[model samples]
Target: MKRTIPPLLTAAALAAGCGTVSTSASSGGGEDAVTVESCGRDVTVDGVPERVVSMHPSLTELLVQLGVGDRVVAQAQDALGEPSPELAAEVDAITSISADVPPTREDLLAQSPDFVISGTEYEFSAEQGFAGYEDLEKAGAPAYVATAGCIDRRSEGAVADTFTDLENLGRIFGVEDRASELVTQAEQDLAEIEEIIGDDDPVRAVQVYVEGGKLYAIGGAVEIDVLRLGGGENLFAGDSRFDDFFAAEVNPEVVVDLQPDAFVFAVNDAAHEEQTRAYLEQTLADTPAVRNGLLVAVDNTYVQPGTLSAITGARIVAEALHG
Candidate 1:
């Protein structure tokens, strides 16, 4: 996967002058330590941050799962309206910062957040137009980028990459034990899924992310790796990365050309789900998947790279394939 540069540093630099420090005795009887390497920067935060700002819904969800949702003071504007019922209560206390527009230094300063957690570094770099790494350093609040959104193909060492991220978050929040428990459960769940599907005939499937009336086929390393765990074959296994395909990509003449036995649609919103369902119903009318009514709709977040992909996503695929 190609990596994109983030814009956080620019804004961080401009907000650089403020410094507020508070100290607390460590429960371990040593100096309280909260240090993390995120977005290529080593950040040592002092004590558990009382006020945290999550710049993406994914981060918000992760924090909530880690039992730190109560600390979040602000969230991205895009995440403000009508969250899933499961997340609505936590979001009620979160103030909105428009991610499409760079958050002003004043806006961030007013939140009095000691830490900022972004879903992707690119959200700060490309979307928010931050200047450089120092920008975050200057803001008196350390910023941590979610590794799940890290585009570094080289750093994705193993399935452990996802587990390590959970541990990293635990370290940041002084809840390392809780993080470990979640990672252990997640790993066990994935392992059980693998055992259940062991030796089964691989079901050929295709995952299409729909946006703006177009279908983008997911492939290359990510989907293939995940599908293999779910005991299924990615129909686009030969492709190296995700690619946008046209009507021609949907060949109708050769039955084998329409190879997938199941279809998964990654829908971004409720409206997108309706649009995708309509598009698939019309275009894939003759495909075995559609003819057999085996279309599956998945949340956009689950299909995208994330910590939840291994367990939650694998379970979804296993059930779909088994069904």
Candidate 2:
């Protein structure tokens, strides 16, 4: 793939200085360290971390993409969505230190990790009994949160945020080349999907998450930005109800009134996808999306904040919307 940044992503980088991530080499305490902007904070990692704890599968997958999977000493093995086939074996091999998704402070500290990375800052929530950033810092472990999951960046996140995280990880792990390669591949993949969708009238869709018959619309997050790359416009992207939130419970009547052109839903597996499709078909049979068979199912992981999987999600959306 051609190593290039997408033109649209330039704006993503310039949106806010808080979301921007950069790295600089520093000699602190007679040790080589890399200081990078993460979650609107400056975190310096002294030397490459040989023992790292990944708080979520997304972060774990990203570390693997950066060619530092071997450094991951412990990870949370949650079945949030399907794991990437290419890296499933390697990811599964990583030890799970706790049954909890975000291991407690005690368990995490016991591992004596030098570095800890999480998809969301919530993983470091002291209120939730998990290891906070301060706790990690005091324990000689620097914690880094992905830009997409930053409290200030989550609502306005985009595909470029993932690139920022990738580059930052590369710098931290002394694998800048590998990170660039992955970013280039993602950019090329998105470009190809966009080219295929060129000149097509964008579909008006709503990304919905269903569980126990409750409906939640995904909006004001990176998924909305990713959907646009696939030639779809979210009906609720500008709604105040979804402002600054990933998903919000929406009334079925509201969806029926909008009569969306398509329904882009997230699924954990094929069965989940089929169940969502069936529910849409039966509950909102009058909607154009249901009648026209324009329901698109994307893996849940692909729809999360700033993930390389968004490329795959956008492709799935592009093919369904334009093909």
| Model 1, runs deviating above 4 Å | 1-31, 77-88, 99-110, 126-132, 154-160, 195-198, 220-226, 240-258
Which runs in model 2 stand beyond 4 Å of their true positions?
1-30, 97-100
State the lDDT of candidate 2 residue by residue for 102-202, as single tens digits: 57789899999999987666666665567777778878888887787776677677877899888888888999999899989988898899887989999
**CA lDDT, every model vs. true structure:** 0.57, 0.75
- Per-residue lDDT tens digits of candidate 1, residues 1-323? 11121111112221232322112112221267677666455667777888988775556767887899889888763321234457657755666765433355557656877788764444445224442234555555677766544434322323345565687778878888989888888878988887778778988787665444545565533334555666677676555332321111223333236557887765545776788888877866777788787777755444333345435556667777773
Clashing pairs in 2: none
- Please report the TM-score between candidate 2 and the true structure: 0.87
